[model samples]
Target: MNKAWEGDQHNLKPLVQLLHFGYHQAMSCIFPVAIFGTLALSSVIQIPFLYRYDAILLILLAVQYLMYRSGLETRDEIKVICIFHVIGLVLEMYKVWMGSWSYPEPGYTKLFGVPLYSGFMYASVASFMCQIWRRLRMDMTGWPGFVSSVLLGGAIYINFFTHHFIPDFRWWLTALVFIVFRKTWIIYRVRITTYRMPLTLAFIIVGFFIWTAENIATFFNGWKYPDQHDSWQLVSFSKISSWFLLVIISVIIVAQLKYVKANRR
Candidate 1:
């Protein structure tokens, strides 16, 4: 440890430690924070001619660029974000088609009733996971066989769509996840101290937070679930299960990248 931080760790007050941890946690969420801030602003403001959604799209793109150019995001992370963007866009297109959700605002940047910037919402989730993983030096142990895990993730993704037409196997998938990741542990650091939690628990915790953000997003009219079409309401807690599965998908992608990069070194 550095001389300054050496005794500092032992003597630090709990409130100070909490504040420090909070700052670091906030740093890991910069992308999500930026996008959410923009959403809050756009909800209340209007431009003369340009659509608010279009302007927000441009702002999000610029933010992505600046994050990269400023060395806050890496080339590999950008690739992951782009992948997430496309995945999100595709899902949004389908969900809007199915009346699962709808974007009510007018925008020139919309495709098939989905605004281009809408994808950034999902990308923001990826950005959060990627940044947090790196910032905390997160690692996993007792991971299930990668091939099986990836296959399970794919099934979970597929079920998201297929459930509308056929039987919903999400609960079963959740069970499988519990089994596969039963022994897996996510290890991360806070300052010089290390902590660990079950990977499945981490997924559930992230899912709950994302569910909270969803409520905020809906309140700002980012998009609306069917229940919100009449009036804004708290998003259903049931949706947390869906977000949990989605987090699994995101984690699988990030973990694969980390694993491959590690092997190359």
Candidate 2:
């Protein structure tokens, strides 16, 4: 043992070590107790009925905003995230209106388990992402936030059978989107450093893991499409191709969004 290392380790006291379990219980409570409370209430009332999922999401977002409020959280951060909420809300609402998928109605709008609020679900996600970026020292500074989201968003959009997000295949063209979008993003948002190559590769690999998780959820939930009208069950080459198709689809969505955003601006 080096003298300096030994001295530093010895300097730690028993009381100081007790801080290790600080916030785990608090966060764990969020999933079961808090979320469950809101969801149950949301689902039970009809005159003010709303999807439990939507209500729980709104609660979480409000909570997240409170958590991430810096002594001086900037207006710009708030603006960017609000835009995310608006865009997501519009996209989902449009899908609903188009009969892409219907949610519990002939013509009912549900928000926060009541009515007239569609954006809160996404506002909550944006706030959580904001908090994560702050902690990771990640740069969500520019188009990276917007561009990265399309791929991630599409993957989330596809697995309606699980989690807060409901999946839709209407925009399957996004499969070829992210690869080219990665190049575009690399050019515009990312400032090149020596570690750029590895960091970019890391992002791609992480995306693959996310895709794998999505595949399992969607596949098990009977949330998949048949190839030539034949269901191959799961765990076959067809399923593997479906995952590959997601990568391609993500790339496409990224590119399409990049184009639209660029041309619009």
Candidate 3:
């Protein structure tokens, strides 16, 4: 009887830990959830005298303000989000011009056929990373030197643009990412226990989830691919590789910012 009780307790312990990990992950995703909720609600509901895209833009602005004022995100984190917003908007303008994907809705906030609120979608990814880093007490081991990390990140960002004109170097960049981060590990805490995950594995995991969210976003008309214009369907699994590279860029920027802040203190 005692042996059975001990076995049950052992099983329950890991289950509890898993639940805790999941709960924290959800909390870290608050910004993303809000953005997704806005996408969904705006799709179904009408705001008089306002376009859907414009309304979404207003709602996201309010949400950002509330998150800052309520202390849900720190000032530094807000800066990070804004930086990513610009980075994302620039990419959006280029991609839309290149006919990669598009905003099908009309909005006053449209610039070069891309909606302003669209940048928030990218910023939300950065928000998640920042929130999770703090909530999980994340750190890195075997981090690469500054120049190598920065050059890799720059290459990844540039490749997003250059791929249209030149040969797509994404596979090459992916290989470099693995080689550069081969020894890097993400150390994070779940409850009282610390866990380690390879940095590359973490990027792939987050990228897959981002790709999943992309499907949901497209279904709600957040944006549409050429294929999705006729009927909604799943985003290509190949895009996961694109997002995998993007996740690396996001992490590198955030990690460097965190390192800078840590050293300043």
Candidate 4:
């Protein structure tokens, strides 16, 4: 009894809180720099130039932080992360096939025996360490979150339209299929969970602005394909709005994560 009480008393101190916080900050900073830095050093980094993708990834981490402010609990983050990325992989592959973009996936690696050209990005995506996302309450019944993520992905398509860089419809269609099926995810057996306002809005606004600005700059700088029409106007509402919707979806993801983590503890 005395030992247990003593341990509780020790954990309740203000200094313990500060020490815990300091430890977390140190860990977060070291992680991104190390992960991205290591990838940068790899000889087989056959993907597009690193700057833009890293910038976007960094912005996403920042957005997650701003929304949670504290952090997330370990939940079902992997399924969510994989679903989104697989959607992206499909889109990217279709883009490559149509000559919408180009990269190296040299001869002999079979996609049903074809020399697929999208190995770099599809492979590079696995490096994100997104297992953290799986720690959330997934909604399998409702159309809201699923519908929203699909729209967010679609909005991604629209963002490039100003430049006339339309991806093949197959990309959009695969995302739609995934969105519809998110309703049947295993987590749906439980209640649909989410976080409250202000924080939700914070994640949306901060994440969106940071991601949009950086990606826009990256697009113009050649790390990504911009609108085929060469329409690079900052005032364009279509480009701006697409990111806004994406932000909405991002907030939903964070909210579900928050609920799952809090409950697990």
User: Could you tell me every candidate's TM-score relative to the true structure?
Assistant: 0.93, 0.41, 0.96, 0.36
Cα lDDT, all candidates: 0.90, 0.41, 0.96, 0.40
Model 1 segments beyond 4 Å from truth? 1-17
User: Could you tell me which 10 consecutive residues in candidate 2 have the lowest summed lDDT?
Assistant: 186-195
Steric clashes per prediction: 0, 16, 0, 14
lDDT of 4 by residue, 1-265 (tens): 9999999887775565556544544443333334334334432343464433344345444543443444441224434444545544565556555555433323233242222222222222221222212322223334355456556545555544423455434345335534543443333111233422232333335445535443443334322343433543343443344444444444445445545666899
Q: Is candidate 3 or candidate 4 better by TM-score?
A: 3
lDDT-superior candidate, 1 or 4: 1
* Winner on TM-score (1 vs 2): 1
lDDT of 1 by residue, 1-265 (tens): 6987977876776667677668777987899988888989988887678898998999999999999999999998999999999998998999999999999888999999999998999999899888888888899999886798899989998998899999999999999999989999999877777889999999999999999988888898889888888888889889999999999999998998899899999
lDDT digits (tens) for residues 1-265 of candidate 3: 9999999998898999999999989988988999999999999999999999999999999999999999999999999999999999999999999999999889999999999999998999999999999999999999997999999999999999999999999999999999999999999998899999999999999999999999999999999999999999999999999999999999999999999999999
Candidate 4: misplaced stretches above 4 Å?
1-35, 43-75, 97-101, 104-200, 203-223, 226-244, 253-265
Q: Using TM-score as the measure, what is the rank order of every candidate, best first? A: 3, 1, 2, 4
lDDT string, candidate 2, 1-265, tens digits: 6998878776863333334222332332332233334434554553345444444456656654654474223454466456655655665566555444334422244642222333543343343333333323343112444456555556544542232354444234334334433543222111221112232343455345435543443333212333312443434433344334333333334334435555788
Two-way lDDT contest, 2 vs 3, winner: 3
Best candidate (score: TM-score):
3
Candidate 2 is scored at a TM of 0.41
The total number of steric clashes, by the backbone 3 Å criterion, in model 4 comes to: 14
Q: Once model 1 is optimally superposed onto the true structure by TM-score, how far is the C-alpha of residue 146 displaced, in angstroms?
A: 1.8
What's the distance in Å from true for residue 150, model 3?
Answer: 0.7
